[model samples]
Target chain A: MKKHRLLTALAVVALIGLLGVFNLTFDSYKLRILNLCGIYIILGLSMNLINGFTGLFSLGHAGFMAVGAYVSALLTMSPELKDTVFYAVPIHPFVKAMSAPFPIALLLGGIAAGIVGGVIAAPILRLKDDYLAIATLGFSEIIRVVATNLQSITNGPLGLKGIDRVVNTGWSWGLAILTVYFIKKLMDGSYGKAILAIREDEIAAEAMGVNLFRHKMYSFIIGAFFAGIGGGLLAHMLGTIDPLMFRFILTFNILLIVVLGGIGSITGTVISACVVTSMMEVLRFLEGKMDFGFFQIQGIPGMRMVVFSALLMIVILWYPRGLMGTKEFNWDYILQRKYLNIFNKKKKKKTVSEEN
Target chain B: MTILNVDNITMQFGGIKAVSDLKMEINEREIVGLIGPNGAGKTTAFNMITGVYKPTLGNVYFNDKNITGIKPHEITKLGIARTFQNIRLFKELSVLDNVLIANHLRLKSGIVASIVKTPNYKKEERHIYEKSLQLLEDVGLLDLINERADNLPYGKQRRLEIARALATEPKLLLLDEPAAGMNPQESLELMEFIREIRDKYEIAILMIEHHMQVIMGVCEKIYVLDYGITIAEGSPENIQNNPKVIEAYLGVD
Candidate 1:
């Protein structure tokens, strides 16, 4: 166990060091993609905490992301920038002059989202499964509609521009690694087990002395918080914000990552986030015209989504549990051969038997 | 001392009365049996007492505290724990994890402490792990602690359910159809196991069962119900010989 812990620590440090080196070597475009990968990791892992760990089929992530994005963008933009951006109606007097460092602004954004998440959970948590999903989806739409109409605060449907480009590999990926570390710690504890128990069976969990509503609320709020941070990072990364940017399609994209990675596995979420984000960028080539020597063909604009949709269908049909199921990628799994032989291969048998 | 008092609990689902005016009392370390035909509301009574359903009338008391209308989790924390009739284990969790989850209510650490994993939190977790191991040992499932609850055999699953219930440190334990799918041999073992749990924990146990041999072998007192009403309540022998109980089970000619 001691050796395993040491190895895990070394692996984390090594990963961070490698990312640090990449920060210096990569150009802006490559760096931006890497940062987006980290942001998606945060979003995917947060979504997994609620949908995968607590078994709450929530779809309010886009709304929470909007809250984070708006809060952080509003906080970090200078009063002069805000006035210029909101020239038609003028920015809110209270927030126009407010600005903070990127980290603190991001944190405030997460807190704002968490507050919204908590408030929404009170009413919608009574609904279960698909009903909960629909209610949250409706809530996300409401947020977007509100953001579109609120000209003074959000600059209406025109959106806000001239925001600072403050996101970087260090901050974004640093937060991502921190997110994975802290959430993994939380899940390894008693409170984590309580939520997992709820996912397994709510009634049985309650009967076992787990408070259903409280635990669900905890996961929801925490998930919303990190998702907000991810949104804040994206806003700063892109140097602009808009209501259209946080539509249900955004939630759907992150949901794809969570599901494709295996819902409950953090390691799966991390790996799948990187793969899906990179794949999205790579698929951008399909959006423009294509040349085939003699004949030229016009590329379908939304063909990337078509291909992604097909992939999603195939994944769901072929491997509903996704790449990892509920199994986490940890040192125990990596050193399985050594551990397996010592346990007379019970671990191997267990892994094989429970995969389905 | 009486551990539980169900005083005239009446549960009405719209026009239908599932359990009407049911009253029962269980003292400390006692084993009581509730047997009934299908839809007779034995489980309904259990639900009311465990705070799964709010009684339409009357009160449920745990250790003289009026616990009626409280949430199920609060009732559990107030020292009443229960198992489902259909064996509701945390299927994907390891057997040890299932028991550890039950120990959640007993932790001294709050949400932040648990999330942050403070030194005190680690100590509490170690304590829970040790206690859970002992719990598995008592239930004869120590060897299978690392195995998933869903992977356990039918009998072991039932036992794990009981062990999980016991992890909550309940003053009153409610077992619903514990021997429902068991063979005679397993049923006999369950009877002994139930007795051992009652004696060892010094807890009042109220179980719903259809197995006559298991109920008769284990219960000191038996309550018989039919069509949401109690037919008889007496010592096991008295209940066995009661004509109303016999009619309720075998039907009147």
Candidate 2:
């Protein structure tokens, strides 16, 4: 255990060092994609906590993200910028007066989302499976609609623009690391076991003295908190935001990452977040004009989505349990090759059983 | 010295009465049996006592406190733990984790304290881990602590469920149909196990079982129900001889 802790500490330091190198060496576009990777990791893990760990099929992430993005952007923007953005309708006095540093704005954004999550969870969490999913999806749409109609507060769908570009590689990756560490610690303790128990069997968990409502609320609120942080980072990264950006499609992208990664596996989410974010950039060619020897094809606006859909379909068909299933990347398996031994033993047992 | 008192409780599901006018009292460290044929509302009565179903009439008292219609987790915290008739173990979790989850209700550390890994929370976690290991050892499941709950054989799964309930540190343990699918040999062993736990933990036990031999062997007192009504309640020997009890199990000629 001591060795494992030491190795983990070293790994974290190495990751920070690598991030520093990328920040110094990478160009603007590459740095932007890297920052997106970190933000996606946070979003994916947060969703996993709700849908995967606590076994609540919530689809309200987009709503929480919108809350975070708008709150943080409104707080960090200069008064003159806000005036220009809210030209259609005057900005709310309270909202106009709010101005904080980037980090504080991000924190307030997370807290706001967390509060919203708690309020929504109280009535809807009694629902199970697809019903819960639908309820949360409806809530997300409701949030979007509210944001669109609440003219003074949200600029009436005009969306905020010219926001400060405060989230760089360091800010995004630092928060992502904090999220991963927090979730890991929460799961390693008794609270995590309670949450997993709810996922495995709710009635049994309740009988075992695990309060279902309270634990579900915990996972939901915490998930929303990190999702808010991710949204704040994205808002500052792009220096512009609109209500359209946080539609159902935004939730679907994060859900896609979580599902592709193995819903219950943190290590899987981290790897797939990086993979899917980078792949989105790499596949940009599919959206642009292409010329091959004798033929040229015009750019297709949404062709990349078709390819992603095909990829998701193939993955679902071939690996029904997703990339890592429910297993995490264990240091013991890497250091001691324990997985290989298990595989070999399984094979040997098969042979022995055949002889019998 | 009554540990549990069920005062004329009735469970009415719309028109049908699942359990009606049932009165039961269990003394401290007593081993009691609730026996009836299928659909006789044995499980329903257990549910009412455990707060899964609110009694349509009357009240349930534990340690002289009225505890009717409370939530299941709160009931467990109030020192009454129960295992389901279908053996509802947390199937995906390991045996040790199954027991550890039961200890969660008694854990003093709040979520923030646990996340921050305060020294107090760490100490509580370590203490619970050791206690769970000890409970598993006592139940003879120490060797299978890391094994998934569902991977265990039918008999061991039932035992694990009981072990999980015990981890709640309950003063009254209610077990529903513990010997449901066990063979005669397994049922005999379960009787010994039930008796052992009662004496070891110094807690009152109320169990529902179809196996007469196991019930008669372990229970000093027994309550027989038929069609949501108590037909007979007395000592095991007396219940075995009662014509009404025999009529409930075997139709009268």
Backbone atom clashes (below 3 Å) for every candidate: 0, 0
Chain A TM-scores of all predicted models: 0.93, 0.93
**Candidate 1 per-residue C-alpha lDDT over A122-210 given as tens digits, one digit per residue, 9 for 90 to 100:** 88899999999999999989999999998989998988797789788888888999999878988999999999999999999988889
Q: lDDT tens string, model 1, B14-63?
A: 99999888989898999999998999999999999988999999999888
Runs of candidate 1 exceeding 4 Å displacement: A293-296, A338-356
Score each candidate by Cα lDDT.
0.91, 0.92
In model 2, where do residues sit more than 4 Å from their true spots?
A291-297, A338-356
Local error of candidate 2 at residue A79 (angstroms): 1.5
| B55-164: candidate 2 lDDT, tens digit per residue | 99999999999999899999999999999887788887889999999999999999989999999999999999999999998888999999989999999999899999
Lowest summed lDDT across 10 adjacent residues in model 1 chain A is found at A332-341
